[model samples]
Target: MQNHHMITPCLWFDDQAEAAAQFYTSVFRNSKILNISRYGEAGQEIHGKPAGTVMTVSFELNGQPFTALNGGPTFKFNEAISFQIFCDTQEEVDDYWQKLSAGGDETAQQCGWLKDQYGVSWQIIPRILIELLNHSDAATAQRVTTAMLQMKKIDIDELKQVAASQ
Candidate 1:
């Protein structure tokens, strides 16, 4: 087991903490489930979940530690928070987008952002996007930004073409 960080992002789930943890670990490299803590009798009384049920699942996605709490549906995931995955190539971006968005809300996809089946928002972005959007030339940056705004999965080739155009 690796040492945990002082601050970790905890995802709240209704009763799918384990499933979500597994799914996330499978998608990201160097990721795995670290530990699973079950609810005790006292905890069950307070949380209303049955004793021995999953209380929290600690996992790592690409070495980034995260915790999934099976805390009832009192709160839901929204676009206020999202995970950003940076990719060096279009194939990398496409793979992640396809896996994360599988069975997710397709309608929520916009500008390289999508809501997963668990309602968690994620941004599959190409690394070159920053370079293009932060180009020394303001006009070039604007062109890249304009092209990105009209995309959903983010086509790096298209963005490159747009940047090369006059």
Candidate 2:
């Protein structure tokens, strides 16, 4: 059980660390490149790769830390568990929705999940999800869950209204 906030997603790529880091930092506010390191001589012989190849690159997206590892094409990011971002308003959600889906695809899950060009999964959920989940009634949570299943990029106000109803 990994805590979402405490974790810094380490993404593996086929030599796209710099490019991917640049792209991601440009999209989100409060995002910046932390550091970048190339394969030193010690790393070259052990891994059997080139000496100057990119080893890792770190970046923060909206204060959340992430590391992009240039570890070749051995592994990939699947839709198993994704980073769920809490957006304050529809504009914030829409901005991320557009940028993230720029070279990616969109699904109809009420802004729950999307896969970026690097095959990274992200959940663009609204801030209301926390409120709904934190509600006193489990039934409300269930209702909100059911409603979320029918859409993508969740509408916060709609969920609030739904929770207020039967």
Candidate 3:
């Protein structure tokens, strides 16, 4: 923790903090579990978790620090907050899309957005999409946007075709 980021996201889960941490670490490269703290009798009255149960798990995903807490089902994750993964190539995008969306809500997939099994929303975006969307020609950008709006996982080749047509 010598040069940690200024902010780290802390996820709230009912009782899957450790499982979630392990799953996330497995999904991303350059990731690992940093620490784990279990519940103790000190806060038994309020927390209500049994002693020795996982309380918080500190982990890293592709070098980004995150903490998962077994804070009960008081709050749940929604689409309001999401993590965006910017990919440089179609292979990168496809790899992430397949891995992160496994067992997730298929109904939530749209425009490169998906909800994982834990209800955490993620946006798997490609760098080419951003470039096309910001093209100098408004018409070309519009076409790219229109094409993108119709899909779930982004297809870099298809987007390039659309951009070229315009």
Ranking the candidates on lDDT from highest down gives 3, 1, 2
Clash pairs, candidate 1, are none
Q: By TM-score, how accurate is candidate 2?
A: 0.80
lDDT of 3 by residue, 1-166 (tens): 4536999999999999999999999989999999999999997999999999999999999889999999999999999999999999999998999988999999999999999999999999999899999999999999999999999999999999999993
Give per-residue CA lDDT, model 1, range 20-132, as digits (tens). Answer: 99999999999999999998888555799988999899999988899999999899999999999999998999999999999999999999999999999999989999899
How do these models rank on TM-score, best leading?
3, 1, 2
* Clash tally, candidates in order: 0, 7, 0
What's model 2's overall lDDT? 0.79
For model 3, the stretches where C-alpha displacement exceeds 4 angstroms are 1-3
For candidate 3, give the lDDT of residue 115: 95
TM-scores, all candidates, are: 0.97, 0.80, 0.97
Per-residue lDDT for 1-166 in model 2, tens only?
Answer: 2325766778888889889999999998899998888887785655665878778888888878889988887887778867766788888888877888677755423446888877777788777787797788999998888888776767777888889999
Candidate that beats the other on lDDT, 2 or 3, i.e. the better one: 3
lDDT of each: 0.95, 0.79, 0.95
**Cα RMSD (angstroms) for every candidate in the order listed:** 1.1, 4.4, 1.0
